[model samples]
Target chain A: MTTGFGLNNLPYGVFSTPGTAPRVGVRFGDQVLDLAAALNDPVFASPSLNPFMAQGRARWTEVRARIPAALENGPLHPLTGVHLHMPFEVADYVDFYASEEHATNLGRMFRPDSAPLLPNWKHLPVGYHGRAGTVVPSGTGIVRPSGQRKPPNQRTPDHGPSRRLDVEVEVGFVVGSPSPLGQPIPTSAFADHVFGVCLVNDWSARDIQAWEYVPLGPFLGKSFATSISPWIVPLDALTEARVPTPPQDPAPLPYLTDAEPWGLDLSLTLSLNGHALSHPPYASMYWSPAQMLAHMTVNGASVRTGDLYASGTVSGPDASQRGSFIELTWGGENPLKLHDGSTRTFLEDGDEVTITATAPGTNGEAISFGEVKGRILPIQ
Target chain B: MTTGFGLNNLPYGVFSTPGTAPRVGVRFGDQVLDLAAALNDPVFASPSLNPFMAQGRARWTEVRARIPAALENGPLHPLTGVHLHMPFEVADYVDFYASEEHATNLGRMFRPDSAPLLPNWKHLPVGYHGRAGTVVPSGTGIVRPSGQRKPPNQRTPDHGPSRRLDVEVEVGFVVGSPSPLGQPIPTSAFADHVFGVCLVNDWSARDIQAWEYVPLGPFLGKSFATSISPWIVPLDALTEARVPTPPQDPAPLPYLTDAEPWGLDLSLTLSLNGHALSHPPYASMYWSPAQMLAHMTVNGASVRTGDLYASGTVSGPDASQRGSFIELTWGGENPLKLHDGSTRTFLEDGDEVTITATAPGTNGEAISFGEVKGRILPIQ
Candidate 1:
């Protein structure tokens, strides 16, 4: 299979050279094409990719078509020694629990005696708003969050560093076109609003989450830091990855039903301390990105450019395909033996967790979604 | 009592004349002092207050001191006929269930089989991130949201316009100075980081919320539209209104405790269709703003300049002082008697709901918060 940044994969990001300001660039092969310098326009010179993202899908397509022709004679910058930043200014972050396998695994582990899934699990896409201010770019250090956590037998919660910190491997969708308030963008219009996709490491504090996520949803437990890959693989580049979603047991409502194949077949791999932990398949997710977006905006919530939504956890049916440590080790009852002769139920200080993924491309090639990696640091 | 905009209460907002661009202005009495035009500088010329808000407390104090002196000879425009937009660009919105009365009311109404209060209700200021894209300014017509709602007897949720619409009376705290990631801001540093407070109307669709908010939390039920007053009342102006929060039964942990009395005794009155409904008291909240801020950041989640956190449904002890229609009307078991002899279990199209509030000012006078009013429009 063909690999590397081929013609079919020109992911956009923000990068800067030594002593230079950040500008929008496209990754092609091992080089970066500076869009602002090539176009000789200041529109793409912003520190973040929000301006370029706000240009909408038509403009985006035009730029995509124009960039390759402009690069034939334009100056190219070496990809080495360049600092990459967050591609866009995140407006809001929404996380959806759309993976049936992951949700069932969590339900079974957390509530052993009760049903695996909630009553409304099959009817709608379950999601909640997340902290957008703490969305950092890839390579940012993950600080172990200290908060109140209650043991099962404890009367009161104790404040300390989280002992059950974990990583949730998922794919995130980025919104490019915004929708006005009181308008619901139908499932068929997903391509018009969504710009691209990226890999996300939703670092979670399971101890804090278990104690605090009652009545309301997760807050500080999952808000400390959410890391995303710098490169954004545009939706147009993933045409070959489209696949039909699994049939719903109970038919979805008319608003959520899409006539097209909305699922993208991608393979995600998670590693910790240079040891392969799991391979969560994104293709097995029960809900598609179109369905998730439709459910989110059906109630008239406006969508803004730079808004982000992530698949909760891309776990598969097998134990080795579990996306989080809680499911893999069954709530830390059984620890995982790493290749470095270390056992871990949760993340430890100095442990580097890396997640990488790839999707099907044209000409029997694969489109790479680089990597989102972060090393855990002791609580400050 | 000081009823009008006094010397101490100089609230800031963004407004524009018919022929000019939007700029930051300070509301004083019946006029607005154009800060940008008055200072002969364009620092405050941005459409949103984010740029000026990021200047930190020292610069804010400097501007506050200099604005009044310069206003003596500066251009003063009448407040009437000016288009008021959202004061600041919301970075992140968090809604806190800090009011004991509201939480207990909700618990008693929804979960009659269990305790009225959740086990973790008093342990921490329970909160969740809310949609920031739909946070509108006051007077913006609220389009009735349509979503799927499952009745108790129905096996599947049915799609339609929300039958049970309500509003949550709240006071929102706006952050001006941001904190670094991994660093928790102490309660004493609240004044240094938070700029002001504004009135918020957290619109809710009770039926939709009840159906979907099980495993996660409120999503579409509360994301439709959240309206805030145009003028932001600075914390410095509320010095005389400060009061001690109600004592906690199980005393909070050290991280959630504060030495200062951070509660402001604001009287919030809710009206539907020109008839009084309830009078929720802000002083009845069990948690203080400082304590809430501390708890939110103790887990290493960074705060941004435009981040906003609202005191969820400020209900008092009396049933007449309930903040939401579900509580005041007791889950619609009893319909509210309107001024025109019409009855209402929930809001109807063309019905205007207005929330006005005031706090104690210097010398026994009252500082007005200025009303946050919105008329309900039919779902599009």
Candidate 2:
């Protein structure tokens, strides 16, 4: 819908600005737009703007609401475009298991008849703590794991480079403001901690995850590599794209229920190794982000900024639209044929997969969370 | 029994020597004994000492096994005369909610009939993400939190000082070397992540926790302030203190079942800042650290060095043995009458509290975790 240059699409990213004070910048086309310079000018200046006027590098949470209320809402919002770099400085990161589709799918495979959902799943947002120190921005090559794998003939797990590194398409959102000790933020305040959203491709080692997940959740299966896009789309901009909640079987508790339509109508697709023919649409999800956010706050736990709540393996109703080939083929019974004649239920090394999503809108311009890409490398 | 200053009375703490590097120290009377230096000298060492030395400070997991060997063989260990500090540098820290007595006691008032424990309760350890950034050493003062709070009778929360600051009596174990990713650490490998145990008093802001917990689990409610003693008591030292796990209604998964009696018969108690009266027996709890550890690995979660999982409250059947004033008073219903005639459930400004836990050894000398103390100051 946008006829002019899409300056409004200038998503901000955290970056180490050279020489100048630590601050923020907006990405327009291929260049970064600096936000600090405008703060000193008459057009943009205030307390919120002060977070962007740092000395070296600042986190998104530090200057989240500061882009001048007027700039965010008025005519100058789209007019200002100063060149700058990416705008992220992540301190800690956490991933949450929110989608019922992803949860149920994984659960069904574990316990078909009884996997309605582990009883505690409905009560709280069950999260296994992840490694924050290892979280890296997008384009970082994911490595295939050489771990204990079980072959049918062996008693002990075969130790070698895993041939089953897989990709999971997910959305990562940033936390803005920190909550108080012992206080749980209500649904209304979920956005307060949400700085923005980014594209996420959670790389997995399916073989490793299955073998190790008996007493704990994923370890090396997850630690191998998880990728996320560099750009951050603020929550304020996605107001128009929010969707209704999917169907639910068991009624959620007071904490999980909400009035707002929480899911995003994101047109999501994935391309394996740059083969344009492999991409598919993303839908058929039953849970919404609001439900996940609401469920998370029930424990009175405070979520930090830069924390990412992943939907796990997001898939559609059928084979082609299915997110992961694991569920798409029901674990390897039916293999998926790649464009280059490689048939697989999972990924192999040196393979690159890209996932991109865009929210639908009839407004001036439709906002999109760009592609999340990762290439697998053989582990020594 | 230990009649005089004897072998059984040794305590542990983190200390730094005037000329040597910082490392784990064993406490004897008022003087400090260094373990690393003694391990290097044969006059102060033994064959049992070789195992401890083999692990080097970089891999202190062997400390747990070596402690018992050193204790059993009787006094040839190098660390005896050699002065040591608290322990090695904590590489990472992860806290857990392991005690049902503590969980139920705390959950009873808030959740009434149905608690949050899932089917995995009897089998696996339930835990959440913890902050390693604030896992400070002993003698750190806990600051009263200044955060947004819902004032009494107000629908909207106001930014104010935390009113219900409390302390939790906890036990923390350190991991030695890192576990390979995606690998399930067998019970035999349990020693890998453990350097030793310490008395930890997890400070909590009950009022703030009550208000903010929802979508995310405890964040600021805990991260703002946490305190722990400096010693790393080898896991072997408490073998004599082993007890049986209490019975549960439902059976747990096989992974959660203990291979041996896992509970420790240590006498644990809390003081009002350090003044105390008689409390219940320490063997009154229903779970063990081993069960918690095994439960953590049940789902294939890999643990790293410096992770500190805790036994939530460590309360007994009686109110007197309660780990926290919050559990002792049921949130704030039971106010504590201090030695100075002060009565309240929460900590007051300048209020000091100390907690000490010990395992009575075969000899009269008690193997102790020593004291973890902190004073609460008004929010700055």
Q: Chain A TM-score per model, please list them.
A: 0.98, 0.80
Model 1 chain B: weakest 10-residue lDDT segment is: B1-10
In model 2, state the lDDT of residue A145: 61
**Model 1 chain A lDDT-worst window of ten:** A1-10
Worst 10 residues of 2 chain B by lDDT: B42-51
User: What is candidate 1's lDDT per residue for B93-162, written digit by digit as tens?
Assistant: 9999999989998999999999998888889999999999999999999999988899889988988999
- For model 2, the interface Cα RMSD in angstroms equals 8.3
Give the candidate number with the greatest TM-score. Answer: 1
Candidate 1: residue A157 lDDT (0-100): 90
For candidate 2, write residues A224-312 as lDDT tens digits: 55677767776666766776656655555455556666677666777788864233333345555555555444333445444455655
**TM-scores for candidates 1 onward, in order:** 0.98, 0.58
**Candidate 2, residue B120: how far the Cα is off, in Å:** 3.8
**Which sections of candidate 1 miss by over 4 Å?**
none
